[model samples]
Target: MNAVSTTSAERVRADLVRARSARSARESLIKGLLFLAALLSVATTTAIVVTLLQQTISFFGEVSPLAYFAGTKWTPLLSGDQQSFGVLPLLWGTFYLTGIGLLVAVPCGLLAAIYLAEFAKPKVRKTVKPILELLAGMPTIIFGYFALTFVTPVILRDVFGIPVSEFNGLAAGLVLGLLVTPTIASVAEDAMRSVPQSLREGAYGLGAGRLQVALRVVFPAALSGIVAALILGASRAIGETVIILIAGGQSPSMSLNPTGSFQSMASFIAATARGDIPQGTLKYETIFVVGFTLFCVTLLLNAVSTRVVSRYRQVYE
Candidate 1:
């Protein structure tokens, strides 16, 4: 009986060892798969950067950097004496639209976030927050149409009596602001909500009013996150292609007039997507230069965000 019991105990031990080994192997396989998935994202980004840089270099060979950067014109396809490719017009147009978009988004979004975070009852929050966020998921093209058909004519024309073209930067920027508002509101609300409740309570204990506690205590604690949210909103506005494309209209000009039709970097890329010139020609290569410029701007924004977060990140107890 003793020998039989020993043999059964050894068999059970062997089965347990095998089970552990199988589990370890499964985990190892999953880790390997996850690493490859991350690597794929890195590889794709590297490929794009390499492709754009190579073409941009080739473009510089055809068109001098001085002419591309300093000149005010952007008519790369213009015949004979009219050809130019200055980048300022595109850059300024992009900035003008993005600036106007931020104006519309930032205050409204921050105010909404403040209400949801500090003031709203759970029932009201539950009802309103999701609907606000739903705006982010709505297709941008729809917003573009709304900008052109309704915004330009009805709001700008009828209410303000402002002169607005069929497709103007002001209309596009306002609509883009509405499109970007959800992103800012969602991120900023999360930031504000993450503030430690103890801080709020302490402020209250010190005889602070609700407004004072919320503004002075909670808002300061969440400043870094709020800044990050604003950065994200700015990036979204800068990269937006479809809304600007449909509503802002593609006529590259160095004008700051909000009511005037202007072309954004995104719209420029979209306008030239058809590769109107033969491959390897100077006209064809202009797209790559523009693309590279956009990429650089995005990279700069991300770098600034990283620096801002690191410099101001709170060390909480």
Candidate 2:
């Protein structure tokens, strides 16, 4: 009987050893996979930066950086014409449109976020939030067409009687505002909701009104996130390609007026890349130079967002 019990104990111990070995092997495999994913992401970003730098260097070899940056005209592809590489016109158009878009998006998006976060009932919020986010998923091309067909002709021309061009910055910027509104609303609302319930209750105990509480306590608490949301909206406006390409004309001009047709940096890149500019030409290299400039702008915006968040972020137990 003793011998039989010893043999059974040995068998049980052997089984336990096998299970531990299997678990360790599985854990090691998962760790390897996670490491590989992180490495791949870093590698991809490095490759993009390297490629853009290579082309940008070649571009600057022939064209003066001052001419590329400060020249008022951008007519490199004009046949039999003195080539101009000044990026100011494109920069102006990009920032002008983005400013118009922000004018429309900021107030409207903030109000919507306030309503959803503070006042809306649970049922309404659940139904409305998803529908609002759905607007973001709609194709930008459709928005472009809407601007060209309905906005320019029916609304701007008929109702307002503004002498807007067929493809103007105002319509494109308005449509771009509508496109990014949901993004701002969603992010801002989440930020506001993240404020602790205790703060709201304390404000109520002081006999503060709902509006005062929302604006004073909650808004301040969520300022970091709100600023981040605005920065994100600006980045989206700056990087947009299709809406501007379709609605905003490809004409590069230094016009500050939104009623005029103009070309944004992103739109120029897309329009030029699609055309028959042969590889290795100055015109072709302009694509990368413009792209690098855009990349730097976006990186700066992200850095600002990080700094703002760090400065203003609140911590609660």
Candidate 3:
């Protein structure tokens, strides 16, 4: 009996050891994969930065930095007298479209978020939210076509009597606004929904109306996330290529008019990249210079978003 009992105890100890060892091996494999994923991400970013810097350095050798930045004309692809490297027009068009997009997106998106988070019933919220988010998944080219074929001619020209060109920024800006609205609405709604229920109840106890509570308490509490969403939408608008290329046209304009034809940095990069331009040319290097500038701007916006979220994000127990 003593020998049998000792044998059973030994078997149990061996089984436990084997189980733990197997678990440890699986954990080790998962940890290694996670580390590799992180390393790959870092390596990819570093590679992009290095490539951009190399090409941009080459570009600046031919073009002065002062001329590239300060000059108001952007005709690098043109010949002789028409070849100016001023990036301001592209920058202006980019921000002008972005501004128009924000004008349409912010109020509509915030209102939708507020309605979904604070006013809507569960069924309504579920149905509406999914439908709204589906806009983000639609192909951008489709949006461009819609703006060109429908919004520009029928809506802007016929209905509104706006003297928009066949390809103009206003229509593109409106559609771009529609494209980024889902992002803001979704993110801002999530932020507002995450606010503690007790806070809402406390506001109600103070006889605060639903609108007042939503605008005052919840909006303020979720401001960090809302701002982050806004920045993200702006980034998306800035990076949009196809819509702007198709609807906004390729005309680089120094004027900040949304009703006329304009070219954005993204549109310029997209249009130029598809051509048969030879490598090592000044025109080819312009792509990388503009791309690097865009990358820096986006990186700065992301940094600001991170700072804002870290500073003001409310932590609820």
What residue pairs clash in candidate 3, if any at all? none
TM-score, each model? Answer: 0.90, 0.91, 0.90
TM-score of 2: 0.91
Output the worst ten-in-a-row residue range by lDDT, candidate 3. 251-260
Please provide, for model 1 over 1-317, each residue's C-alpha lDDT reduced to its tens digit, 9 standing for 90 to 100. 99999999999999999999999999999999999999999999999999899999999987899998898998887888888889998998888998999999999999899999999999999998899888878988899899988999999999999998888999999998998899999889998998888898889999999999888988888998899889999998888888888889888777867888888887888888774557887766888899999999988998898888788877678
- RMSD of model 1 against the true structure: 3.1
lDDT of 2 by residue, 1-317 (tens): 99999999999999999999999999999999999999999999999899899999999998999999989999977645578899999898888888888899999899999999999999999998998889868888998899889888999899999999989999999988988899889889999999999999999999999999999999999999999999998999899888888888889888877777989999999999976779999889999999999989899999999999999899877
Among these predictions, the greatest lDDT belongs to 3
Native-referenced Cα lDDT, model 2: 0.91
| Count of backbone clashes, every candidate in sequence | 0, 0, 0
TM-score of 3: 0.90
lDDT tens readout by residue for model 3, 148-243 = 999999999999999989989899999999999998999899889999999999999999998889999999998998899899999999999999
Off by over 4 Å in 2: 1-30, 79-81
Error of 1 at 68 (Å): 1.7
